[model samples]
Target chain A: MTPRLTAFNVVSLTLGFAFLYLPIVLLVVFSFNESKLVTVWGGFSTRWYAALLGNGPLLEAAWVSLRIGVLSATFATVLGTLAAVALVRFGRFAGRTLLTGMVYAPLVMPEVITGLSLLLLFVALDVDRGFWTVTLAHVSFSMCFVTVVVQSRLVTMDRSLEEAAMDLGATPLATFFQVTLPLIAPAVAAGWMLAFTLSLDDLVIASFTSGPGATTLPMRIYGQVRLGVSPEINAACTIMIGVVTLAILAFSIASKRGLAEPGRAEGA
Target chain B: MAEPPGRPAPLIRFEGVTKSFGAARAVAGVDLDIAQGEFFCLLGPSGCGKTTLMRTLAGFETPDSGRILLDGADLAGVPAHRRPVNMMFQSYALFPHMSVEANIAFGLRQDGVPRAEIAERVAAIVRTVQIQGLEKRRPHQLSGGQKQRVALARALVKRPLVLLLDEPLAALDRKLREDTRFELKELQARLGLTFLMVTHDQDEAMAMADRIGVMEKGRLVQVGAPAEVYETPATRGVAAFVGDSTLIEGVAGAFDGAAARLRVRAALGASSPEFVVAAREAPAEGSAVTLALRPEKLRLWTEPPEAGTPNVLEAEVWDLGYLGDKTLVRLRLPGGGTVRVSRLNASRRPEAGLSAHQRAWIGFDPADAVLLTR
Candidate 1:
């Protein structure tokens, strides 16, 4: 049975969407403003976007952030997938509860505390905190998110496929590589994308771990905001939002068309 | 069924094979011999250890005790991957991501067979299974029957010494299941491969198997030809599990080798308190025993059989169902229980001249009933 769309539902839906998207819409609109003042609409122009292209420090920081996102997401995907497999397929083992807790604790832990503890650990280890440290921090927290996404997929996977592979004369390692890995590849890809986005969006953790020559896009944006707000900042935010949105849409369409059936994922 | 000429020696043997999971025994000491080229079915209810036994043979489960022998070679340390047995899982377990051809070729590829040979064999098996044009389709695109054939093809392409089928027809619809039952039997015979199938459907086992092993609670209770198991069950549990049987509890009275008598209280009316049950062998006098009789073997009469009727009881029709080909009549006996008698509708009229609440006489031959001392 289809539910009736009442007036209250329509009103509530409209209000909820407006509350969620109004700030982003205003920022996108103001990014095209001709005036130096961000709030005032002084006719549409692309001068702020042009000025953003010439900003070397902000561009360099963005490049650094992109590299970090890609590297950390790759590492996190591997680690998280292993953790998920161990949790779901290993049945019962020693320290399983502790390992599961560690895998998920970062998801709910306060960012400041995670960042502080990571920084303190790096200090105690006498390790230099720089781009590598920032990547490590991103991997640590985003790995938890990846673990959650992949674990849910692994839990519902039909174990019979693995058994069928083994019964067909594939060894355990071969069966895992040929059957189980390919079956869960889509979820792993999704988790990687999620980790990438999380790393790109992080500011607090990056701030704690970053050292000289390791300023990320978020740090640069924050520094600019501290000096004074500009249309250039709004333009940069709009570009970041656009890139992330485009990435998500492309990922979804690619995934959906690659395998029409939700029950199975074919490796490309 | 006649044994195929030159029946090969036993292909698989289970000697005191027992497997347990922590505290519960999944497969108790099961000793069975399945000869080469024979189709054997393990029939049982759910969780009766039939699947577990099949799994052990397929090397998915290691027996806690006892040795599983294949062609006189003991299989103790061999894993499933190395076993010369292929299983068609009940769920089909087709790699959903792969095409039908890839799924069929997977076993050969895993064995490192040449690509040309693998393709040639896969093509031949697909054609043999009559799934020619479906090679390019994924499992999700195929119907239930088609998926079943794909699973069959995949298992058969390996050309293992024995093929294990776990409820092979279970996922198909009733009509499809009946059709595939015959097809699977024909395929097994044509390929000359020993087939060990596990199923709970008695009709499937009866229609396809040369021998059926009935399992109950992790134990092989009875093993025989389908006709033998159906006609003469060894125990009360096997009788009830194998088919619809009406068990009458009674006390043994007369003792003889050819025939014995049991004093059973009739189930329907209050008039007859004592009834005589003819059995092949007598239990000790005054000992409790049960009499098992099949429904189709029973004959119902309007008034009563002549005084010479051996196992006759006066009963009242309790309920009736017209099943197109046959009419099922439930009768209430003298001692307060119900027995179902199915009669073929061999006449033009649908009714069997019997209605509910009508007084009738239900009787069977003395040899039709079996005495159960359990």
Candidate 2:
């Protein structure tokens, strides 16, 4: 049955969404302010957005962040999916509990601790801390989130499907690719999006691990905001929000289409 | 274990196969053989290792000890994918993402069969299973019965030497299950493929199988035709598991070797009647035995039988279960023991008309009562 929306429910729902999105809404509105002061509302103008085009360092940081987000999320997804499959399917091997604990430890660990540890490890190893180190750190932490997403889906999957594939004379590898992968694609896609977003906005880890050449968009924004919150910064934040929103919308639409096609075919 | 004289070598053989999960044995020392083109059923209650035994043949579960030979070739280390056997999982396990045609053609594609031939074989199997118009639909788009047919078509398209079905009809509704039982039997016969089905449903095994093997606690207790297993169960476990039977505890008195009959003193509390029952082999004199009597075998009489009538018992009607085709009358024996008598409702008018608390006389032929010594 559909739930009837009472006055109390409507008030609570509105309050919850307002609390979560009010700041984002304010920032988006102020991004078009003609006045340089961020707090005061001025006449609407696109000057801040135009000013965003000429900022070389900010654009470079944005480009770097995009590359890191894509590369780290892709690598993390592959590694996380493998880990999920091993944990779920390879029944009860030695030290399985310890491996599972280590895989999920980063999820609950403070980012400060993870960043500090990575920084120390890079220093002890004498490896240069730059784009690669930041990317590695992001992969290390975000892979756990990916594992959590993919593992839940794998746990609920019907194991008999794989058995059926093998019983039909498909080899184990073929069964995995043809049967298991296609079934788990949605979870994998969701995990990729999560990891990508996490890597994109990671400031503390990037600050700890990155060196002279690599500055992520979040790090650059933080650096700029420390001096003073500017309309230009608001514009950059608005653009970031727009990109993330568009990506999520595209992903959900693609997944819904994948699900709805079967129903449509049945109707035909 | 002995092969029939005229039959050829068995198609699949499980020679002393045993498997255990941790401390619990699932399939313990099961030795069996199935002839080609035979519909063999593994019948047992749940957790009796019936499915585990079938999995051993499918190469899904390896036997801890002993050998599984397929056409005289030992199947040791032969993976499930390479085995010349396919299984229709109980859950159907139809690929949710694949179209029915693609699901059916999966095996042929794996073998690198030509695209044209793959389509041809897929079409043929689809037509055989009578799901031709639904080829483009995915599994979730189809109904339960349609999904079942697709699962069957997928397994049969490969033309494996043997088809293993793990409770294949278990997911269907009761009416559909009944219809599918006959359809499956007919399909097996028409295809001339060796089929080994695992089920806990006695009626399904009885209706479909050429022979049934009754498993008990991971061991096969009896293997025979349905009638043979029901009428002449090798052990008390098989008797109790295969069908509803009233087991009367008794002690063997003496065996008349010439007549092939054994005398048993039943242990009903007050009126302990001595009965002469037919048996090929008798337990030692005075050894405890159980006499398994099928409810339908007993004749219910409103009036008492003649004084000299053998195997007759006097009992009061305890309850009446009015099944559509037959009525089961539970009778309370004079000694506080209970036995059931099933009377077929040939005429629609409630034949005996005996209500609760009414006295009735029940009797069965000596041959109908099976003496189980195990």
Candidate 3:
């Protein structure tokens, strides 16, 4: 059947996409400008890229953000997987309602509130705000995304596989490792990627918790934007977008290829 | 294959086993014994608690109050994995990710058996169930029959003392199920292992079980050989449950030593039918009773027999069903009740030369009818 595409729908779709993406496209195009003026287009050149390469503080902030993304993503994946398992597999127990609320509340909670609360918590605990504080804040919020992703997959899993493993004489712990874990591995990988991207893109919580000498990439970019709109900041933003898009593309392609391969015949 | 009538060191015994989920008792007070090396079946309709009873023996559910003895050992507090029993789940429960050989060898590997021994045993079982080339295929890639064989191979490779099969053939098509039923019985006999199966299919249970326990409403109403349960049911419910049987409600008149006279009244309150039914224990005088008669036991004749013929009732053929092997004739008795009589099609077009709405006489011997007190 042919889809009914009216004139209003065509106009609305084009306008909506242009509204969402035109600014990013303009920023990317201007990052390659040869002239220094921000609005006027110039001939294509990589001079801003050259300038961004030599910026010491920007490079340090990028490095700090990368380290925090990797570490917090890894920790969040582990903790979130445990939380998903407990919520999905265990029937019911004391404090289950409270635990479920804590796992999902951050997904809808306002970023400013989360940031302010974390700042107050760190200060009240008398812990110095620095790299560790930023990493902890990112982990606390991004872990909720991982939990939601993995929990959905856990809910649809066939529970009989676990029962079959235990019925075949494996202990409960052995069954979890050999059967349940392998079945939900894809969901866990997806959750980890989600956590990594969330931590990498976060600016509010990191800015609120980070101390002097611990600026992340977003904080550094915002500081530069506050001073003056520069092509260098646009260049940095474009690079960050490229890195995240490439990571997501790689993950999707790798998972698709994994699925395309035939089931491995162990004995043969 | 026949043993003495007495209990001969049963491999599994359930004594007053009862289990409840919330307020509903899924398995109420029940005591049963399964002899070693015997093929026993718990047969009933759906929701009859047969599956729940089997699950208790598999150690999946702990009974509320009673003892499950395995080889004379109390099975209380035994976890499912620790029990010396394995179940072929109704769904087959084959791991979707594993190859057939891996699935069959899973239990052996769990016991820390040597790799060489596990491989050898798995291969032998594969050949035993005749699933030779499908060893490397995953479960989803195989046909239903192949999955059934793989499940059977997996359950047998564990070498449990008593194998609990939960409708092992329920998932297969009719032909494949019949073939597998024969193979399962033969395997049980050759291995000399106790086989306790649960099924809602009466024909499957009758064909495979050495003894069948007919259950209803969370209780075992009757337990006997297939012929014994079909021929002499303990109650009206058991007679109607095990197979197709026509029940006649009557009231006892006179109780002689061997036979009791009953007067059956038609539903419209016009016609009165009388017969002498043989009973092992006769009911009291002027009390309600039921006579259970199997369809095959009644012979339908177009012309009434001689005047002295006993246990004969005049009926008009209401419906005629021509099954391949036999013709089932539903006859409306003079008392406004219907009774089914099955006649073997010994010859082509051998339907007693009878058709629907034709007058016929249905007769049976007094010894073939069972008198039910309830």
Candidate 4:
């Protein structure tokens, strides 16, 4: 009976996995088809993927998105990490709960609302809403997500490590750079990756906030998909899938190496 | 190790320091003087100001009143990082992300020490703590004992003026804690640093500290060598906390030199010695007092022993526990409360004496009991 239950569980899990993955599988498989229609599966061809590389404007937009993602991710990581540390490590303060709520509130708020508010704020402040505006929007929203991720890791962190560093002649600032920051590096990296993904996939915020000459890859894709269904968008999506998969793999491998490398908790 | 570097005063001193959390005073006006190279322990029950004192020393909490002096420097405003002290957290608190080498070198690097010097010091401290060959491994790969050793190494690597340990052995198992107590004592001696350890466990404090400070209700009740604290606790709190003891409170009616007479009336007073053992500096006659006797000092027998034994009380044997080397007998005294008496199992007599519902007599020498005056 136990074996039967185990077999049943495994079968259910397999079906569940297939249900979630089947669409993505079909998308990848159809990307190679020579047919013009998305539903038809024709003979395989590398023409679309090849076309993806040669599309000058598409590649340029992708480059713009990547640059924005990298910059926003870095900025968000620093700000979010500091906010997380302040929430978790520092002593009790009167505004602590309110501050933490504000940091994490954006994670669940409507993206359209954030975009609209940000647009209004920028206009009121007389700041141009363009590539930099979109970048700022991504950073603003991503900061909260990054803060949540890092805060979860920080909450589980042993405060004694920081105290140990403090006791060993390291100031609070020094402890952050030496013990606390190094210890939470993997979480920080993970947060950055999450921030980058959020920025890369962003559309609503960018659309609401961006001006001319600030077309990101998502914005470009949105324009193409709006005009009509095309193989080019599918090709672009396939390339993204490859890049994200490779990134996740690289990150996972590096993190596992770091985990295996430390035999003991040392300072921070 | 080797006591780090010293100035010309006690490594750390608490001068009438008090710490309050909201409405509760966790540490109340504690005055302490810790000598250089002293393995001092602040011991008490939970929430009894021992950890509070340690925290004040480690700069985790600033005292609400009075000052802290470290090596003759007024440290009232000195933060934990600026203080010439380090603390090994009870959780080990090893950095989970960095390699052991990086963790050990973290403080040194933060202090702007050359990378070579940090490496050298890390290696030296790690070697001293015997955590070699595991410098490249993350904390998850290490065992609990190994983690504790690494923590010790980290705290000592920088050679702080004082090393604070907050219940360092509270996380370990019983057998492991017992074994590590000796190791910790040996480590403190070898390092010769002023070690201030906070623990709720009396045995751990007694085993590890050259001097033990007993705290109760946010007050430092007594500070002395382990034997001094154990043999003659200054208060009922210390007596009951530092070790298992039978306490009997009564008013003293008469006193004569080393012996005293009391108007006995507490629970288990009937089972107490016929007379109280007065200390050299006991309170005035007719004052209320408490008498305490350790379990190891009391002897229990199946039947009343010989005459002229001085102190004897009839009791009903209720429970029994046989430790390999000793036997603990719980006797329900006729005076209402129960008392435990531990006897060494030198021979097979304990087996013969061990029986429930048996009548027994508990006796101890007058010198074995003490009058607590706190």
Instruction: Give the candidate number with the greatest lDDT.
Output: 2
Interface RMSD of 1: 5.5
Clashing pairs in 4: A261-B136, A261-B137, A261-B138, A262-B137, A262-B138, A263-B137, A263-B138, A265-B94
Error of 4 at B14 (Å): 1.1
Pairs with steric clashes in candidate 1: B266-B334, B266-B335, B267-B333, B267-B334, B267-B335, B267-B336, B268-B333, B268-B334, B268-B335, B269-B334
Chain A of candidate 1 gets a TM-score of 0.93
**What TM-score would chain A of each candidate receive against the reference chain A?**
0.93, 0.91, 0.92, 0.89
- Looking at candidate 1, what is the lDDT of residue A30? 96
Give per-residue CA lDDT, model 2, range B1-374, as digits (tens).
Answer: 46679878899999999999999999999999899999999999999999999998888899999999998889999999999999998888888888888899999999999999998999999889999799998787788899889989999999999999988888888999899999999999999999999999999999999999999999999999999999899898998888889999999999999889999999998878999999888789989999999999998888988888789988999999999999988999999889988988898787556899998999989899999999
**Clashing pairs for predicted structure model 3, backbone only:** none
Deviation (Å) of A21 in candidate 1: 2.4
Model 3 iRMSD vs. native: 6.3
Name the better of 3 and 4 by TM-score: 3
**What's the i-RMS of each model?**
5.5, 5.7, 6.3, 4.6
lDDT of each: 0.88, 0.91, 0.85, 0.81
The alpha-carbon deviation from the true structure for residue A155 of candidate 3, after best TM-score superposition, in angstroms, is 2.7
Ranking of predictions according to lDDT: 2, 1, 3, 4
Q: Which stretches of candidate 2 lie above 4 Å from their native place?
A: A1-19, A247-268, B1-7
Candidate order by decreasing DockQ? 2, 1, 4, 3
CAPRI tier of model 1:
acceptable
- Residue A121 of candidate 4: its Cα lDDT? 96
Best-first order by TM-score? 2, 1, 3, 4
My TM-score estimates for the predictions, one after another, are 0.94, 0.94, 0.91, 0.86
